[model samples]
Target: MLIKVCLNGGRLRRDHPAVPLTPAELAADAAACVAVGAGAVHMHPRDADGNETLAPTEIAAAVAAVRAACPGTPVGVSTGVWISDGDPDARWHTVSTWGSLPAADRPDFASVNVGEPGFTALAELLLELGVAVEPGVWSTDDAEHLAESGVAARCLRILVEIIGVPADLAPSLAERILTRLDDLGVEGERLLHGEEAATWPMVEMAARLGLATRIGLEDTVSGPGGVNVPNNSALVRLAARMGA
Candidate 1:
């Protein structure tokens, strides 16, 4: 089972002082997380002023730095709608241009929420660029749509995002989505995770089931036993211990 650490999402430094926002910070944090048993990392590239950006230069810088810091570890990025003003066409264009980067600067994979508009186009671009796609399904509607889109079979894996739901309810919801994917013959790694309050609960559940899981400040600021964690590495280490 793999444990991916989401080094940073669209969060600012103020969201968590240790959230890595620059290439250097990301490299350092990624290295530490890997050393503590993380098999992969997911991060957001930032601009000169630390705002999240999909610009090739920024993406290259972040990807290169992290790879240098943690050799052989896969690093992925988010391709959320916020990156393109909620315009699917614009998002597609941005992702299309990512293929122009030199080999070493490209991410190993990228997460594309199938629920978003034009996800099929974006996923196609990533495949054309040799970047693996992680189909993200945040709701039952998204899962049903993904099964119908025929994209799940081509994706590197599936991201089961359990958001806004209480911990007690997340498992059943996650299982329903998983069952739907199963019925559709979507077979591969299925990463089950939840946001905020449900994060650790789902992580523990994933571990018990021997399924892959993830943890980082992006998913939750809390650590084992509900204590606030100090950084991405700490969160990863605590999750590793839990899974072990």
Candidate 2:
């Protein structure tokens, strides 16, 4: 199973002392997680002011650093709509700038949320740049959107991401999303994951179902049994122990 360590999302230094924001910090944290058995890495590249950015320079810096730290591990970044404040046109413009970056400095793959505006166009752009696209399906509706959008078959994988739900309900919600995808004949590799309160349950569920799952400060700051985690490596270690 592929256990990707999400280094950080829109998290800030106040969210966790070890929340990696700078390129060097992301590189160090990614190396640590990879050393502990994380098969891949996903992170939101941050600007100098500690905010998520889709700028090519910032993305290149983060991707290149992580690649140097963990030579063969796959590195992915978020093309979240919020980075551009929901302006699809601006997001596309900024991402288009990435074409100027050397291949080595580009993300191996990028997570494009299907529910976001202009997601298909963005995914198409990523493909044009030779980057694999991992479509993020946060709900059954998102799954349906992905199916209807005609990009499911071409994607590197489908991210069945469940968020804003209670732990007790996560697995069933995930099942519903999976079932929806299956019913729609959305054939492709799928990575199941949940955020915040639902993180570990989804991890265990993913392990039980033999699917890829991810964990890190971006998903939760607490470990199983609600213990506070010290860093991304610690979360990866615990997930590894759980057979993720």
Candidate 3:
């Protein structure tokens, strides 16, 4: 179990204006997150346009900065279909672009959302490239499909996301994930995260289950105390408190 933080999600600039987009700002946030005990860090590489891109240069630059800032921390990037100008084979292009990146600046891992067209291909590509894979399961069928698809057997870790849902239902989502893991008869690294207010409960449940967790503006625009968090480290530190 490893606690990670997602630095930026989407449109967070105005919601929590302190969210970092520049490489220097991202570097500072990574350093602070690692200092506070988060073992892994996640982020989307956004250019000056504030749109996520999977281009080799964008991924390379951001990865280099974060690695330099937090030498030993595992760096993972988002490979979501939501990325702007995402290709019909976007997963292939985006992930292969990451795979071909320089070793020193290459991402340690990258997330592949389940229940999508390019899901299995991205998983295989990541495995073949030797980049750790973190598969995010947002629904019961996603977990079931992964189990049957045989990707789960090779996944480096699992990140169960219950986005846009209520907090009270999160524990149930956690329960189902555990059950799905059992049903599949496969167990590996796992973490819980969600969108907005329910994000807190998901983290709490992660702590209670002694499993890994993630927090950041990507998941919630508001701070833990409902004040806007200046940076991702603020959310990481708060998640640490739950486990502390």
Best model number under TM-score? 2
Clashes of 2: 0
State every prediction's TM-score relative to the real structure: 0.97, 0.98, 0.93
Ranking by lDDT: 2, 1, 3
What range of 10 consecutive residues in model 1 has the weakest lDDT sum?
221-230
Ordered from best to worst TM-score, the candidate numbers read 2, 1, 3
RMSD of each: 1.0, 0.8, 1.7
lDDT of 2: 0.93
* Pairwise lDDT winner, candidates 1 and 2: 2
Q: Any idea what lDDT model 3 has?
A: 0.81
lDDT (Cα atoms) of all candidates against the true structure: 0.89, 0.93, 0.81
Q: Candidate 1 on 1-244: residue-level lDDT in tens?
A: 6899998887777788999999999999999999999999999889988788888899999999999999999999999988878988888888788878997889999999988999888888899898999999888788888878867788998999898998889999888988888877778889988988889888988899888998998888788567878899899888888789
Query: Candidate 3 residues 1-244, lDDT tens each?
Result: 4689888866456677878887787888888988987898898988768778778788888989999999888998888877835453865865677666668877888898886677888788878877778898988888887787788878878888987777778778778977887787767878887788689888888888888888887888765557766667777878889988
Residue runs of model 1 more than 4 Å from their true location after superposition: none
State, as a TM-score between 0 and 1, how close model 2 is to the true structure.
0.98
Candidate closer to the true structure by lDDT (higher is better), 1 or 3: 1
